[model samples]
Target: MRRALHKWGAAVVVAAGLASGGLVPNAIARTPENPSRVPPVALVTLPPEAQATHKLILAGGPFPYSKDGTVFGNRERLLPLNPRGYYREYTVKTPGLRHRGARRIVCGGTPPTKPDTCYYTSDHYASFQRIAP
Candidate 1:
């Protein structure tokens, strides 16, 4: 039992290191300037039915509009009707601006019967530009 446990621990450590990209060959190493953001796109295409369903869902309501939008709800429990499902608020820097200000972004989720939208605020949520699709 003791020997088996030791081997299992070593295997776990090896698996973790490989998962973190430590096992990649030096020839295919990535540069510091251009880091990978997303995984490679799949070459084999989805069937027409699957593709159509995906398009419908992606095109569904609560589309992610801007980066500034707000996101609420714990990962475990999410409610669509709540305002938390719609938008997110963020701060971004503008040209000639010493500091950043509040901005709102839309969240992508299941399509609502009536799409919920958010507006970008210039003066700290005082006003907003109603973004329409």
Candidate 2:
């Protein structure tokens, strides 16, 4: 009878230790939720000369050229120029005409490949200029 009681008591102590040591599986971890926020969009228009200048700048030319072919005195400053939304960068590559061969270059945002392509904005996207290339 005594041996039986000792065995039972030891078993009870082991079970209690296991329970307090987190052997159970129902415990849950807490996590935070994401915030709700949306950025605004800007609208801008450029003159004929500015548009032409922008295009010339896009093309590898007399304009200040960065390794990425972006015509900006300071890239960091240009990025946040428009406060409304995030500024996206893009690169376009096209086959040159006849002997022209192939051309690969980077541009701000996304520009239309066709000559008749045009863009318009209402808020000031920092500074707006036409891409003539």
Candidate 3:
């Protein structure tokens, strides 16, 4: 019985991961209606630079980068679907980088400063994890 449960348990784990929108290693799973529900990253857990960037976002930044508060195309589609201009991107300062690094904060909503949701990406938009309020 133990061996039987172990054999079936792998499938159960994968199923549970899918149901909870968690990634199953080496598996490709996504749909237009169900874009990947990326995991959430706690506000306090973020790097100091990211934390500062988040504050700047809420404070209506006088951002360092010219493109800090520009529209994020979301071309990678890793983020949840939103119409054009619904998302905006801001830079997260990366130490030792002369130019803007991969780290960024992408917020979605109107008025820019007051966003409905925010996400953080360290991989140049290749992936994003929602920033938990």
Candidate 4:
């Protein structure tokens, strides 16, 4: 009876962990609730420069680059297929760089400040990784 009770208690704890959302090891990651066409980027994993750029974007920046907040146009179609001018681009200042580096943050929506989505490009638009959703 004692052996059976201990096994049952262990099984209960395992079941409880799985039921409490994916806060446990080997659990499936939680995805965005919205029908997001793009994946999400965790701010913690990004580079320090990219983190700073994200902060500037949220704060409505007085960005250092002359072309800091210009229309991205989404010509490459690398983004999740948005319409014309739905995206705007911002520069991520690189260390010891005199000009705008290849890294950029492209966001979608009107007013630029309230984009529906945002993507980070490190390869000058050869590819894009979703940064916001």
* Top candidate, metric TM-score: 3
Mark the 10 consecutive residues where model 1 has the least summed lDDT.
1-10
Q: Model 2: per-residue lDDT, tens digit, 1-133? A: 1111122121111122244554434322111121111222221234343344336544534443233233332132322233322232222222243321222222334332222222222122322223332
- Measured with C-alpha atoms, the lDDT of residue 73 in candidate 1 is 36
In candidate 1, stretches whose alpha carbon ends up further than 4 angstroms from where it belongs are 1-81, 102-116
User: Between the candidate structures 2 and 3, which one is better when assessed by TM-score?
Assistant: 3
- Between candidates 3 and 4, name the one with more favorable TM-score: 3
Model 3 TM-score, all chains together: 0.78
* Residue 80 Cα positional deviation in candidate 2, in Å, after optimal superposition: 5.8
lDDT of 1: 0.32
| Cα lDDT of model 3 by residue, 1-133, tens digit | 1111123121111223455556556643444455566889999999999999999999998899999889988766667778999999999989999999899999999888899999999999867889997
lDDT tens per residue, model 1, 1-133: 1111122121111122355555533322122232112222221232242233233333542332343224543221111234455534434344465545343222334443233433333455323344333
Candidate 4 segments whose C-alpha is farther than 4 A from its true place? 1-39
Per-residue lDDT, model 1, residue 122, is 42
Give, for candidate 2, the lowest lDDT window spanning 10 residues.
29-38
The residue pairs found clashing in candidate 1 are 61-111, 68-104, 68-105, 69-88, 69-104, 69-105, 70-87, 70-88, 70-89
Q: Clashes in each model (backbone N, CA, C under 3 Å)?
A: 9, 4, 0, 0
Q: Spell out the clash pairs found in candidate 4.
A: none
lDDT of 4 by residue, 1-133 (tens): 1111122122111222345443355422212221123457876677789888877887789788879888886644446555667778899878898889899988788767776767887889756778742
Sort all candidates by TM-score, best to worst.
3, 4, 1, 2
